[model samples]
Target: MRWALVLALTAAYPLIVYFSLGHVEPRYLALLLLVLGGLRWLAGGAQVVQARWVALAALLLAASTALLNTSVPLKLYPVLVNAVLLIVFGLSLVRGPSAAERIARLQEPDLDARGVAYTRRVTQAWCGFFVLNGGIALVTALWASEEAWALYNGLISYVLIGTLMGGEWLLRRHLRARHARLQA
Candidate 1:
């Protein structure tokens, strides 16, 4: 489906960059692709507004990060290119789905209400994390220091870890509530 294609493209970018550039680190590229591919998979499966938005935000942030990588030195061209791509990705995600669409999907008889709510909350947290990470990256790009890059990268990794934890928590809470409701 569309999600599979997006995931493939996301994975391909890093490989292409590594093979073509020959200077880019394979580990970094692989990590980026893995994160992006995972985000796309999550977004496609998301049934709540918050989860969808969070996945979208993560995707945009990842794309922006990739674009920024192309301009570590004094290169205005890569920055401009990345900026445009970021805008495109942002607009596409926003226009693609509405909260109503997610809500409708969640309203199915077989759907667990608590699970949907938790998904929404976790997605919102992810959106916040990505926004913060992107802002830090932008600031670091302007300042241009090795310390800045290190700090930004570290923060991004922390955000991703936090997101995973939040997701797990949400799933657990949802299951607990579902169990209680069923008992009642």
Candidate 2:
């Protein structure tokens, strides 16, 4: 139930900001975010190091927003999310097993050298995407109007993510078929 509420709030974040802009004070919104951070921290988020860091970041952002009494920090949440993702994906590339390889191994435990290479390339692609996306997100947060910011972060970003995933799936399928033909 707590997870559900958290997820709902997180998903509705853009809309919440968009609607609340005029009527609600930014500090109150920051308080809500602080509540969310508290909930996450209390909900076993600390067990996972990544989640703990995310929760801490959220708490910090909320605190900053409260202190500044500005909506800028609230607007920065998407930028923060993208930065975290970029770090995670970028680190996986530097570390032993890339994140794409890790996820691929879940279904194909006997992943070959070729598969390893492919996943590594995919991870690199994702890192690039994150860098681009994060840059745009930051631009929107800082300079764009609230409506524009919400439009990109809330809607367009999801579409771009879906498009990337779909394109990858299609490419993977084609590569698998080509490999099978070569083997035959």
- Tell me the tens digit of each residue's lDDT in model 2 across 18-114: 7898898888899778876776666744236665676798899898888988888898887777887788888988985998999899999999999
TM-scores, all candidates, are 0.38, 0.91
Candidate 1 regions with alpha-carbon error over 4 angstroms? 1-110, 154-167, 170-184
Q: What is the lDDT of residue 160 in candidate 1?
A: 64
Per-residue lDDT tens digits for candidate 1, residues 1-184, read 6567654654344234334344654334534544654655565553344335434554554555466654342212123323434443344346633232354366553545655565455445445544555565566656756444444443444556577777666866777888889999
Candidate 1 positional error at 133, Å: 1.3
- Itemize residue pairs with steric clashes in candidate 1: none
